[model samples]
Target chain A: MSDKRGSRAADRTEAIMRTALELGEEIGYAKLSIEAVATRAGVGKHTVYRRWSSKGALFLDSLLSLNEAHLDYPDTGDVIADLRQQIHAAINLLDRAPVGPLYRALIGEALLNPQVAAALNDHFITPQAEKTVARLKAARDQGQLSPDFDLDLAMGILSGPLYFQALIIQKPLTHEYVDRVIDALFTGMGPRP
Target chain B: MSDKRGSRAADRTEAIMRTALELGEEIGYAKLSIEAVATRAGVGKHTVYRRWSSKGALFLDSLLSLNEAHLDYPDTGDVIADLRQQIHAAINLLDRAPVGPLYRALIGEALLNPQVAAALNDHFITPQAEKTVARLKAARDQGQLSPDFDLDLAMGILSGPLYFQALIIQKPLTHEYVDRVIDALFTGMGPRP
Candidate 1:
């Protein structure tokens, strides 16, 4: 299509996604509707359909294209310090309402729906996991971690506590747990310095 | 109420809940219906309402009454071994397809629905938490754990990683993660021994 039409479509798609995100927050995932998003976006239903096929697809797009990226590491050449900083940063994110609820809802929804699950695994988790891998690789390169430290196990170690807090504990994501987990992770689990 | 009518009502309620549970696994939480359960149970729709007020509650009763009993543990002298055994037993429960999927679905659906969430929190988590507390207290009394260790934190340390693997890793609950977490938990944060 022409440049002008492409730009127009992009704007309309963003608007629809914005509306869907809001509706998803307000009414919850089970009640989310494409029609509601179209009405809220002030776009024609056919135009909405031309882009995404269903509510799940629209919501997937909305979730994937979110602007809020996770906290990136600055690499101060200290792995332990970097991990502490990162854990504290995660605490702040989990404490934030918009980020936490959306995350919980998305994770919950993805568990049941395969399309949404695949979209999330490929689009959302892959990017974040890559970033985490880079951080761990940087530590390994600097000889901060053991040469044999598995990236996947490191992922499990760092992330296991945070996911535990969000899913099972179902309490306020406190800085205290972050401190305990981070302390246990670096000083306790890793190779003796 | 006559004894015959009361007994008939109780039987109908049981039938409806059982049917709802079976269908809940067959379809999913999203597609469960009271009408279908009533038809399958060979009971009038009103009979379902005479017990559970809605589809959610009916499904809750069905799932709740199933395998509701906690694992019975003998007062074995070794607390650490008993706790390890408990984690292993939980992993066994998670390995079953019907029990596992139904649990994840139940929790996910509970996150979306407030009433279900309340029921799940009260009926499932609270009681399990209490059982865990009892076991941990027994361990503490047996002079196994550190004197100052909080039961909640200790429990979190033991079981949190297992939940992390099953839900986040989306893997079949493995014996490896289970034993790894158990080993780490027993060692405490203080020493190599």
Candidate 2:
């Protein structure tokens, strides 16, 4: 009986998250609300509040639901290859139609709303950033990267181009562009003479 | 008499722009309006509208007002030094408190508002990108950069770290970070062995 109840609860939670993503993509984060999400999910507002403290929390979950699978931090003993795969995966995730718009909305909301920003940083940004940093540190320890490599700066060097291309310049996130970025950066960070 | 009139008009424009910046800093961009600007500047609403067609245009002008002086493309015949100087100036400009917040707001609005994005691109983004690209092309032609250097890819490599540090990571835009980024990129793009 308990197992059956647990399975049903999990299904409802997934349903609610699915509704939130759809609504968020359609209406945007600024106008997304818990009430609307609950209504769309065919659940009571109390059900959503029981799971999430605020709309930002719900939005964060929605983003994670859509993105968690693609955010693999591969450590294949080749730092360049691992970083390239990780960043390329991220670009693919962000390039999808609703996902791109969804990210833009989340980031836009984060800029204006401190609560949303904190939630996003705490739940989404920090974890991904930390994972990338940890992978770089491992690479450094393995003697694949320079001893002088600053992890934070290196992360910026590796991932910054993709972010710039996707968000600021509004350019297409192509695989060839990704290859060039990785090559340029990897060449620079290779063993110094 | 016409010259006097032109100078007076220019002065009013400056005054209005100054007031807009102050208000934008105080209340944030989402709440900033032409009406507030007109009232703050002690000018008529019609006067504000006569110069700018939309609030986004006014905001773009306000950003340009603060940034135009620093936006000069340095061409000291040294590609590395010129790019470094250019990026350093940009970092300094954005590091200012109001300017950083203003940029975040503009970028946030740009994601949601097409007109704001277009204005930002037309006035600020395109010109700076073009300047950087032109300078790089000139350097390539001068045989300063490797013939294999891709201008578009190089621009992404050069400017990406700054945008990443400022917008996504929310880290301090340190001089050391800028130097390291420039060195890494410059080393990568240097002539082959």
Candidate 3:
């Protein structure tokens, strides 16, 4: 295809994703449909279908497009502080619209749909987890964490609570909550010496 | 109502719940319906609807009926060992058929439906959390944990990782994984003193 054709295709894809997010937040995942998204985006149904096979696929892409920057972990040489900052941002994202509802919906979809689940884990969950693991490894190397710290378990510990609160209990994610989690990890839950 | 009538109603309710579970496991949640459950149970649709308002409600009751024994915390005076045993059993449940798929389907429904979410938190999540909190309190009293250890965070810490693995990453939950999480909690992740 010509450069102009390639540019136009890219634009249409972005438009469809944007419309998916907007419609997702508006009508939620259950009610939103590809046809409606295509109509709103001024694109043909075939164009949307050609790109995304299902609503879950479309929504996952839409959520990732908006969430790329939020997944990065900062390394200011203080692991706990950096984690607190990043988790605070993550919880904040879950506490607000567009991302929060969209994410929850995606999770709902992922649970029921194996295809969506695999795609979500591949594109989103695995990458975010890897970044966090990398940061924790850096901390471990720096002696900020124990050399033998279980990085796999650490990954789950850092993320599991927040996800539990937000997705399972449907509770509000607070900054204080983030601090509490970080403090628990750093201080440890074991009996004092 | 007459005692005989009440007994009959109770028997019918049990049958309905049992059928709901069977149908949920057989056909899965997304495809299972109230009408189908009623038909399978050999009861009128009104009978099913009278007892539970929705499929989620019925499934929640069905799950609780089967899962009540699994949620209890064993106070063997060894908190870590008890937790390890309990988490191992919980993970075992998630790894198998019937309960695993049914619970996953319920979670999927709960995410999209607020009433289901609230009922799940109230009936399942909160009670299980409280049981764990009570166990932790007992441990703290016995000097097994720090007095100031945040039980709420601990509850999340204990269950969150397992749930994250089972529900989010869709990883296989194993006995070794349970031991790793318990060890992490007991040993602490902080830098060596």
Candidate 4:
């Protein structure tokens, strides 16, 4: 009986988060409010306040849920294919309407708000970032890559283009672009003569 | 008589832009206003209005003048050296308090305003992006890169880490990061062994 109530509460919380994310897109983060979220979710303001003490905390939780930041770990046995999968996931993630603008606001907001930034970095950005690193390590253990390479640098190489596509170019990330970047980064940019 | 008045108007325009950029730092874009800029620059509101229809446009022009995006082109014989100079210039440009936030806000505002978005893309982002592509083409012609490279992919590879470090990391684009990225990218991601 007790467990059932807890599970129901968790479901409701999840519902609130979903509603909040929808509201974030309909209105900018600057305009997002707890009362608005609660009203939209068909819940009382007390329910929202009890769960999330601060709007930033509420926004942070809602954002993490929607942004798909700590994305799925690609487990394709082929290391290169796995990286391609990771990059592909990034492209798809950015296709979500909320992802791009929220991220732009989140990063700039993070510049001034340390707590939100810390939550985003720990629970959101760094985890997805480290997933590729871990996979690269696994590849290294299998002797798929040269022993001398820096795993971190390799991850950066894979992730760099995706971030630039999203944050800088501010456009839809495409598969064709991803394949070529992966091909080029893996092949080398040195004098090809 | 008209020539003297034109010269004075140009001086006033420059003063207003310089003042607007400076004030955006001390206050912030959210709070920035044309009247405030006029007050600080000791110019009349009509003077600003006659030049720029709105605050966003004024700020846009101010940001361009501040960054001097017009002068970013480098004709150095070596593509690598030209990019190094640009990266160094970016480092210097970002050292200013308002440049980072102002640029972020401008881009963010661009998302909401179609005209502004078009202007930013057409005038600022695309031109800057294409300049890098032009340099990459020069490199390819000189046999510095593989002939099969996609220009967009190449741009992503080169600028990705630089953008990540500056935007995501929010750290200064240090010489160390620059050198590492340039070196790793030139050699490719996987280890050389």
Candidate 5:
């Protein structure tokens, strides 16, 4: 029965994390609460405190709970195509209300709250950013891009427009807009004769 | 002379806008007020009320006050050089605490407040964005870019990275980083040989 106990604990943890994400999206980080999360998840308040030190800690874990969505980074051999697909997917996710507001709130919180910022940077932001870098480095290795191509700059060119349009400018993150942005970056990064 | 009265009115308007921008940065939008702004500008509160309908309106005008800094959109015949210089100047402005926090706060406020968003989009965002598009169109006309280039998308590629870095990612806006971004976009947007 020890194994059963472990699995039950895991299930409870999953439920709590899922509830935290939902509450975070519905009401936002500013209004999200540990007490609400405990009651909604059908667990005791101490259960949450046992796992997370504070609301920010709980929210950070909830943010990571959504990372499964990013696992399928496209790798179709054509680096440009893969990059475009990945960015398009990201834009689509951001367009969804459940994910978009939560993400923006997290970013705003990151700007104002150091603990939240550190959690996001250490757990969510840096790892995902590194994946983008790795993909570009792989493309560079395959001779799909120029030898002198700056990987960091190429990564920025590829992803920057999407975030700028969707997040900062608050524009509609449509497929057409994504294509235009990708085409512009690829033309800039294409192999020179 | 009537000229003396006109100049005094202009000076008062300038002072009010300046104070609004300063107070907005020092505290933030949530706590900013017309009364405080009027007091800071050495004008009566009714004077502020007479000009602007609300604090958001006043702050929007304050934002426009800084637009003179961007008036010199370089047209030196070298489109790439001019673009780089323009973007570099923008990055520098964003890096400063005065304009930077105010800009970020506006964005944050925009997410939560529709009135502020409308004011920003109608006045500050759209008008400034059009100028960038105009500059690119001028370059395309000069054969510095392809005839078929999407001017809107090109604008996103050029400005998006700077904003994505400084605003969202909260990275330091360095001259070297700006140069790399410009080089990447120009390479993508350069005339297809």
Candidate 6:
């Protein structure tokens, strides 16, 4: 393909993805369809199928395109504090419109479809988890966290409650909730010393 | 109503519920329809709908009937040990055939349907959480657990990581994993004293 043709294809792909995200946010995952996305984008349904194989794949792409930066973990010499800040930001993103319902929809899809589950794990869940693990590893090296605890398990422990509340319970997450989780992890929930 | 009719009605109800559970385990929640379940139960579709309004409702009822006793928290006078024991049993139930996949389907349905989500919360999630909380309260009263942390949050902390691994990551839940979680909760994950 010529340079102009390549640029035009890229633009059309972006338009379709943008349309998918919008329809997803508006109608949710259960109702959103590739046909609807194509119609809204003024493209043929075949155009969409030619590019992405399924609705889950399209939505996954659209979600990753826009929301990757918001969840980046920061390091500032305090592991707990950094975790608190990042989790608060994550909860804020996940609790609000677009990302929250979109993510919920994706998770719902992932549960039913193995392909979506594998793709979601590969593109989104694993990468984000690895980022958190890297931060925890740094903290472990600095003696901020015990080397005794499994870092992978620690990652799940840090994240599981937030996902449980946000996704399973469909509750709004609060900064106070983030702090409580961090404190529980740091101070331990055992008897008073 | 006559005694004969009442007994027949009860028998029919049990048959329908048993069929729902079996079919749910066989085909999962997505493809298991009211029509299919009714057909399998040797009842009319309207008969299935008469007792339970939706598939989620039916599955919730079926799940509760068989699995409730397995999750009953033991009060062994040690909160952490009790939690460890109960969680192990719960994981064993959720990790295997029948209950595991059936519960996953219910959760997937819950994510997509508000009515199912509400029903799941009312019937399954909230009740199990309360049982755990009640156990934790006893521990708090006995000075085994610090009175500072929120028991509700504690419940999430206890269960979330396990759910995250089992449901989201699609990983096997092991006894050793349960022990690690309970240990983290009891011993804390912060720097060594």
Model 5, span A148-168: residue lDDT tens? 666767546666787767766
User: What DockQ results do all the predictions give, each relative to the true complex?
Assistant: 0.21, 0.41, 0.75, 0.47, 0.42, 0.68
Predicted model with the maximum TM-score: 3
Q: Write the per-residue lDDT of candidate 2 for residues A1-193, one digit (tens) a residue.
A: 9999999999999999999989988887778889999998999999999988778788778767876877978889987788778877887887778778888787777777777777877887778878988987887778776566556666677778887787777778988889888776666522334
Of candidate 5 chain A, the 10-residue stretch with the lowest lDDT total is: A184-193
**In what order do the candidates fall by TM-score, top score first?**
3, 6, 5, 2, 4, 1
Instruction: Give the clash count for each candidate.
Output: 0, 0, 0, 0, 3, 0
lDDT, candidate 3, residue B185?
73
Specify the CAPRI tier of model 5.
acceptable
Per-prediction TM-score: 0.72, 0.87, 0.91, 0.83, 0.87, 0.89
Q: Which tens-of-lDDT digit does each residue in A1-193 have in candidate 1?
A: 6999989878887888888888888887678777788888898888888877666667766865564454566588876677767667755754566656766777787678766666665655556677778987887777666555456555555667677666655666677777676555443422332
Predicted candidate 4: interface RMSD? 2.7
Query: Looking at candidate 5, what is the lDDT of residue A67?
Result: 55
Of candidates 4 and 2, the better by TM-score? 2
Worst 10 residues of 4 chain A by lDDT: A64-73
Q: Which residue pairs of candidate 4 clash?
A: none
Per-residue CA lDDT of model 3 for B1-193, tens digit only, reads: 6999999999999999999888887777889899998998899999988878777888888877875787688889999999988877666665678788788878888887898898788778888888888999999999998777898787778878888988999887889988888888767788768
Fraction of native A-B contacts kept, per candidate: 0.15, 0.41, 0.77, 0.54, 0.36, 0.74
What is candidate 4's lDDT per residue for B23-140, written digit by digit as tens?
Answer: 8888888788989999999988998999887777888778777666633758667766677777677656653455877776765565555666666666666777778788778888
Worst 10 residues of 3 chain A by lDDT: A89-98
Q: CAPRI verdict on model 6?
A: medium
Alpha carbon lDDT of each predicted model: 0.66, 0.79, 0.84, 0.73, 0.74, 0.83
- The lDDT of model 3 is 0.84
Clash pairs for candidate 3: none
Residues A1-193 of candidate 3 have per-residue lDDT tens digits of 6999999989889989999988887888889999999999998999998877777788888887875687689899999889988887766665687688778878888888898898888777888888989999999989999777888787787888888888888888888888888888777778868
